[model samples]
Target: MPSIRCCSSFALAAALAAPGLAAACSTCGCSLNSDWSSQGYATSLGWHLSLREDYFNQSQLRSGADSVSRSSFAYPADEEVQRKTINRNTLLGADYSFSRYWGLSLQLPYMDRHHQTIAEGDTGVSTSDARGIGDLRVLARYQGFSDDAGIGLQFGLKLPTGRFKQDFVSGPQAGELLDRGLQLGTGTTDALLGVYKFGYLTDSIGYFGQAMAQIALDAREHFRPGNSLNLNLGLRYLDAGRFTPQIQLNLHGEQRESGAQADRPNSGAVLAYLSPGIGVRITRRLDAFAFVQLPVYQHVNGLQLEPRRLWSLGLQYRL
Candidate 1:
């Protein structure tokens, strides 16, 4: 029993699926499309709930696509020299939908993070602050081919529960640790795959697309983490009054990191973003959303640290 125009564009496209600072590179963390938009549209059924938030700040310093300066990262630059990272992300979702195809979903994340770095010749400037929970996803979907289901397919897992050997509580690497791509969890276990589609080109417009992947599976202590992909494409505007407007383009990529506590050349990247949003219904079951993700292309693979804009907000319910 899903209506209100199919969960209002998946609760405003999950506000671009924030997902916290999923590791600073290696394709980076979440770019949206968590379990098919996280809150709705698995093609009608039952149960639903969602909550999301995502913020970003990564202080410039690029490489593959230019922008790199910060006193050459340090002295005689042998690398190492990151300065700033502040991300806040919280996501919580739950869904059922055992009909119209199939469905099951769960996502929970939390991360506060803060960091600063400088080393390779040392010049002070080393810090860290960690927060709780991260990593934990579970998904499943299928959209009976036709029957107005609009196509779908997804699968998931990504559990490692969160918290992985964190360290560096303050200053000059106080207590060391930190950096397995910026901990908070990456302790292995990962696998997810995806596909999605939506329709309608008129009648008030509608569109959607998705792709996902994560990989990993095992490798901890000696580090592994790397392997990612995310893609989203959206458009929505259906009016029946109650506001609704959307836009999206998102994209992501990754592949790097390996044994020996990797950092394999600053991980990996190939980002892109452009989200824009609005959504509200607040009735017939509730809904609300917001987004703004700007990046429009980045390249990374060396220096790292990026983030010029990113913001998200969300809420959804139907139970």
Candidate 2:
């Protein structure tokens, strides 16, 4: 058996490192691995590494003109404008376990953003592309309670380490509109709380679930800081003492508080997604998995940005 002191020490380390791993969640977003494992415990010192990529295409804007005619003069009364944008995200990270109940993880990410506008005469303006590293995150998980009862608690923190500049822009003209719209970091701290549970349905099949929430501490002008909640359910099949196939579904929502900035309005947003994932075990000491995130509903600040279609792929190695 591992010494109690050793386990406690590892737990402390994981808790302290939680902030770094939490930052990674900003780009990758929260995942289903609330405690870093479905079992809530590690058999030995272990490491997990993963990579992910994401792409986004925004909707096009439309405009029309209004005209008024009088006996003396005729003039256009109104004009319209629209914009389009694209974004990409790349994430990389790794984690280490000191014992079955304790572990630490960290992640870093890079982001690219592009914007453009088209006018009525087939004329267009292309904004420069902006690329740079995003925020960083650290995470820690401890199986506070485990065994026949099948329950545990995991805590996490997020730190702001990414670059933040008010004047930085993709085009020659820089302003708050662009800075706030294309923010790379929230410039604030965030905290997470989660609960985990698992059970067996049969000798070869098992089930796991988790509930998580996050709170952000800083608020940007016209942007209200907010909280998010996530719930996950998974089914796992064990075989040959080597490979396990797993499938999972997740539901999530977020609420934002109103802000004071007059130029920007504060509004709430909600999102729901259904994802299917699979895990493969290469050996007793190594495992990998991949999944796609597809949105079912999304409302941003009372505006609908796009149709519910997005996907993410990731691979993990355990050592």
Candidate 2 lDDT tens digits, 142-261: 664754435656666666665445342433243424333344655557776777776667767667777767777665444434566667777666543444455666665555443442
The TM-score, computed over Cα atoms with residue i paired to residue i, of candidate 2 is: 0.69
81-185, model 1: which lDDT tens digit per residue? 787787787888888888878887888888887878775667777788889888888878877776777767778788888887888876767897887778877
Best by TM-score, which number? 2
Once all C-alphas are superposed, what RMSD does model 1 give against the true structure? 14.7
Candidate 1 segments whose C-alpha is farther than 4 A from its true place:
6-30, 34-37, 45-59, 62-69, 72-75, 81-101, 104-138, 141-155, 158-217, 220-222, 226-243, 246-259, 264-291, 294-304, 310-319
Instruction: State the C-alpha lDDT per candidate.
Output: 0.71, 0.48
Consecutive 10-residue window with the lowest summed lDDT within model 2: 9-18
In model 1, which range of ten residues has the least summed lDDT? Answer: 14-23
